[model samples]
Target: MENLPKKVRSKKLSTRVDLTAMVSVSFLLIIFFMVTIELAKPKAIDFNLPDNEWTYRGTHISCGPDVTRIVTILLDDNNKIITYSGLLFTPIVDPKVLNYGKNGIRQELFDRRKNITEYSTAIGKPKNGPIVIIKPSKKSNFKNLVDILDEMAIANIDTYAIVSDFTPEESKLLALK
Candidate 1:
């Protein structure tokens, strides 16, 4: 019997794959994600802080803020809020207990804003809104403070400050049964 010649086989290619493109693509994706994360970072709120020292008539002098349009809100525990316009001693709108929401504090704020605008216009001044000063006592919760801030935003109040320092008179007023 004649033996048949064995067929020659083609050389087998390497099964291992080159990872250069995959590594480069992965690195590029990582860099893109990092850049996007940096761009998505939150920005800080810009605040215009008043000058600590005031110079008056070529001399440094103490000056008091005009309290006419200033509305002070005292926050107490159990969702109690006492609001008054101007200084406590000589208040434009006497202190009155108010609740949260539209019919309560929101309405008061709207009325005050209207009154203040009219008063300013009558006095030959630009129509200015009220400057609210929120005084949140230690007893007041964070939720109450947030709620008040929401109200301020809802009322479109531009000028307002959260003051923690409570005067003796204000503390006494809050203590009233």
Candidate 2:
């Protein structure tokens, strides 16, 4: 019997994977996210806060601008906004309930601002915009405050204040309305 040469068996090779590419890609992804986060920082609303005196005085006292230039806005519950010119005690423009939107508080603000500006110019007073006082009642929500703030910005009002405290008389007036 002829002995056949033993067939040579091929050596089994273990699969080897290079992790350098994966590690580099992961590092690139992390760096990309970090750069994006650094570039896209959260935006904040710019506020011009009053001094301690005004804070202590609250909305009851007339400390800010003159009565002629002042416009008070009260934010109540149920998306109701009450606006009037000057102090609540002696209002230049009678208090009227207003809603939110272009036609509601926004229109009133625009008209008031324009009228105030014209009046100031006619009276030879310095051409200054109306001073808006935003008073959010206890029943009011945050959205009301934000909407009023947006109105203030849209109206291009320079002088404005957000007073948390409401006078007793003001509260009564709100209840009546």
Candidate 3:
């Protein structure tokens, strides 16, 4: 090859890379993480099923975190307690409300406690502890509802829930909380 003389001649040049594919991949990874992380996380209260001889029946009511006793209460159309599953039981009894203030509700609560004990004994898991689920009808009066709640509290129930169907109009009723 022959060498040529250069008279201080030079040129400036640059190159650019297309990062569209990399950005697309990064977006896909972000979406995957968001979708999975949102579902995998546990919420304020994780519900767990307790070992109970339950029959397939009316609506189920669950409360509190997983791995604990959760009482399930079933109410009849007449706004009376038909059956309640917990520490106390009245054995397929039609629980009537006297609404005679403290003494009346207390007596009913005592009967509930006795039933629970008897059933627990029959099932060979005798524990005199109190865990009740009060299933009152939507038409039940506030006084009756409060009375049941008070009785449950008096029975030493720290955790329970008032089960009811959610309606659009009733959604605003959340203010009662």
Candidate 4:
């Protein structure tokens, strides 16, 4: 007490938390995501995958004029996938070709795989052919529209896009100018 300073010293409080644990967890999450995400380069049918880094944000990037091999899907007035390669695969009225598989042999996803394996040779590969391009018309039902997507996925049709026309929209904007 005899050696104490003339000015009184105030007590100090500091609540410091170490952030090393949080930084470790963040790094672990980043590594997990990097490992789990598919690293395969974008494989394509007709369109060249854009080199632009800003536009690759969706499951299906839209098709523009640069696209070539496209499987254009048109819906007749009845809204079915009426024409594929100029053939009437889906029909109107009688029998309703689209749902023909509904009442037939019911196969789950597993069953479908087993059958696909058994008939793998019979089912030709699409890799050797013209690149696939999908064109869906307006007014098509969401169900049928998605059905096309499902089939494409099942068929492993990886490289395709839903066709879009830039000319019309661009023309309209040009006219305004």
Model 3 stretches with alpha carbons more than 4 Å out: 1-49, 54-91, 128-131, 138-144, 165-177
Clash numbers, per candidate: 0, 0, 3, 2
Distance (Å) between predicted and true CA of 13, model 2?
42
Cα lDDT tens digits, model 2, 1-177, are 369888899999878988999999999999999999988998766655432222112353445545667788989999999999977777889999999999999999999999988976765655566878899999999988988888888888877888888899889989999
User: lDDT per prediction?
Assistant: 0.84, 0.82, 0.51, 0.40
Give the lDDT of residue 8 in candidate 4.
72
Candidate 2, 81: how far from true, in Å?
A: 0.4
Off by over 4 Å in 1: 1-64
User: Considering summed lDDT, which 10 consecutive residues are worst modelled in model 1?
Assistant: 48-57
Evaluated with lDDT, which candidate comes out highest?
Answer: 1
lDDT of 3 by residue, 39-92 (tens): 999877542234444322333335432112334454333334433332222224
lDDT of 1 at 101: 95
Best by TM-score: 1
Clashing pairs in 2: none
Q: Candidate 2, TM-score vs. the true structure? A: 0.64
Look at candidate 3 and give me any clashing residue pairs: 88-116, 89-115, 89-116
**Where in model 2 is the C-alpha error above 4 Å?**
1-64
Q: Residue-wise lDDT of candidate 4 within 148-173, one digit each (tens)?
A: 66765665544556664423532233
